[model samples]
Target: MKKVIPYIASNFKKDKIWMRRTKPSKRQYQVVFAIDNSESMIDNNSGELACEALCLITKALSLLEVGEISVVSFGEKTELLHPLDKPFSDNIGGSILSQLAFKDKQTDVSGMVSFVVQMLSHSRNQSINFSENLQIVFVISDGRFSNREEIRKFIIEAYSQQQLFVFLIIDHPKNSNSILQLQTISYPNGKLTCSPYLDNFPFPYYIILREIKSIPEILADALRQWMEMISSSFL
Candidate 1:
């Protein structure tokens, strides 16, 4: 005996391109950005730089007509700075960027992951019209995780449910070697690395370091590149 799969589309009548019976539904995409706010982030102008980067990214996203975005920051605890359900507006971006609060405490990576998972799950359940196309999670951190195994497990769990994209931002030069080591072990398929500290070399390291003071353009470009990559892959 052969089994048959039901064709729901067959139940509906076909229409022409210009003369359509049913109106096309709009597709909505949601992207969530998760930033790390550990004590280490406060050192070496990272906190300030991160704030600028976040402001730029959110500002850019506000201009895009594709989907909605939510921003979350985590240190010893996690907090939803912007709700995903809210409209992408200049006011929302300004409100989120204005809260440049950084904690001089440890970051709980696992806890942050748990918070994100819960948010995604809740959103998925509550959403009446949701797309399963792209769910992005960008993580910016300077140091390697103390709870490496737990973080890995959380990533795995997240991946099991939705597509995961991690953007690890290394802000400190002192943790360069450690960052490389962590990237080697923690990141799968070599998808993570340190943010470039130098734009042009052979001039002066201090010049490059000073230029790093402005992170808004850097992060905005990085996110734009990532989105372009995703679009290209789809094409």
Candidate 2:
């Protein structure tokens, strides 16, 4: 008892031993997903693959507990499957999958982009400096849209708002048409290069997937690279 008392008294007086203080993370990551639900997605089982990819993404985000995600499906009209205000959970995959279906005949890219832009704009209006917010919108489609010019206009608007748009084109491995279209739409005269892994981008970026099953891993890797890029910029 005497020995314990002396040790306690010495520690209190010296104030040497204590738990380390840690600061909370200031970085905010907001991800928005726009999936194509047109008839083409059903033909190649693209719809199913997209659902699987979304499930995997939610699972990964749940595990990391680093970011919040919102999902929307677009065809003739836009449908919001998940909203940002809703908290993420591990078992929400099944619920999400049950809500998605490929039934619409037309791909409404412009409508989807406009909706996402408004959502981001509203969120930004509430904050003072949104520089810490990393806003990324992932569009999973077969590179087919109803109106090309409208889509281009919205893409520029998104860039002006400092939002990065990633187009994940669902096509065969040998096809390059979608890649070329993405480059042209995002950068008319500017030349953009992309590989299978999707690296290096001055403006918006894209990825061409041969197999639908690889969407989860590829998207996860892309997010990791973006995070690393942001971290290094601070150093």
Candidate 3:
């Protein structure tokens, strides 16, 4: 049992007040990053950056109390760099992230969707109550889909889970259209754009999920802002 249920009764005794149970269970965040390593993301070292940034984020997320991080890299193949069953800890997060190997084949977004959907489903089933377990799925891609309809179907199904929050990456026009029907997460305007060159991109403060070939300190900022927005709802 976590927290005192609101509006509960407090009884007055001879000299003491009897109160309801107030044991609090900590709210934990399980963040999963699914990065695209498909052939399409090879340009400008995007594939390499995907893995690197994921590692950085994983390390950062471990700083939070009761935070767990898992990563899945997909090309034509989907590989689980970090297992979802394991909880993230500061000492081991980096080692787990470094194991994210990639395959250079055509991008199969539908396959990625299916793999993550299954993984999340399995993870959810582990806990009977999901209210204290927040599952955040970050799908970062160049926005190329071999089967849009199939991916769309899986995305909607995943959204039905109260704890899952799916954030799709936007880099091309095609990426924009894929998310038109999917509004599972309330993103800052339902759009996420990445500039090839962050310097050329205006107003760095507004950036979310920027495609930085070189790591940016702003990524930490973006994550903090994101964490703040979802804290009231989940935490």
Candidate 4:
């Protein structure tokens, strides 16, 4: 416990490493997640996957900055599991595990994105110096989102504001009708394509995750992305 104290004191400011989608700073760190918890995803252990992924990602973010996380779960409908810009409560992970493991609904990527954007916009507005804040949003799903254009539009809009948006589409049997297939349609935008295995930043970054299925892998990828983002500063 003695050793941990000084570490906490020194690292408390790590939260200052905030990224409103790019450039990790050591303040105002927030993690926004728009998760698809439809029955299918749950059946495929996506709920468990979510639990693992969230823990891993949050741990990585914590290293650079103390982070606040909000989660929005969506299906044919959407509900806020955690409100945007709020500090994480105790045992929050257990609450999320129960929700994701049991949630039933339809896939509505657009709706989820809309909810995320609204909440984030509100938080950003409340900030007098949004330019000084850093935040990252994660949109995780198992496919079959209903609105393509709307999701695309909001992503572009969020990116314009310099907020990092990640679409982690883990494949499952229920995704049979999933139209998020990359080959059939172009990704986020022509110039803004991305992969979860690595982070891409044209100017900053937007990650579209696919194929990754484990916590360690997720952590590696996330940490790599962070390193890439920080390293870009030298060039």
User: Where is the poorest 10-residue window by lDDT in model 1?
Assistant: 1-10
Better of 3 and 4 by TM-score: 4
Best model number under TM-score: 2
Please provide, for model 3 over 29-124, each residue's C-alpha lDDT reduced to its tens digit, 9 standing for 90 to 100: 677888877666654234555655565555445532335678787787888877866776655655654554444667776777678778877776
In the range 88-119, model 1's lDDT, one tens digit per residue, is: 78787777756646663777778888888778
Q: Which ranges of candidate 4 are over 4 A from the true structure?
A: 1-26, 59-65, 101-103, 173-213, 226-235
How well does model 3 score by local distance difference test?
0.54
TM-score of each: 0.64, 0.70, 0.60, 0.65
Global lDDT scores for all candidate models: 0.56, 0.64, 0.54, 0.57
| Worst window of 10 by summed lDDT in candidate 3 | 1-10
**Candidate 2 runs further than 4 Å off:** 1-23, 172-203, 224-235
Q: How close is candidate 3 to the true structure, as a TM-score?
A: 0.60
The ten-residue window of minimal lDDT in model 4 covers 196-205
lDDT of 4 by residue, 1-235 (tens): 1111223333323342332345444445567877777887766555555555565555444444455678777887778887755556547756875776445656777777667777777887798866555556776765544456667787777766656676665554344433233333236655654453222211123333433344444445554565356335311
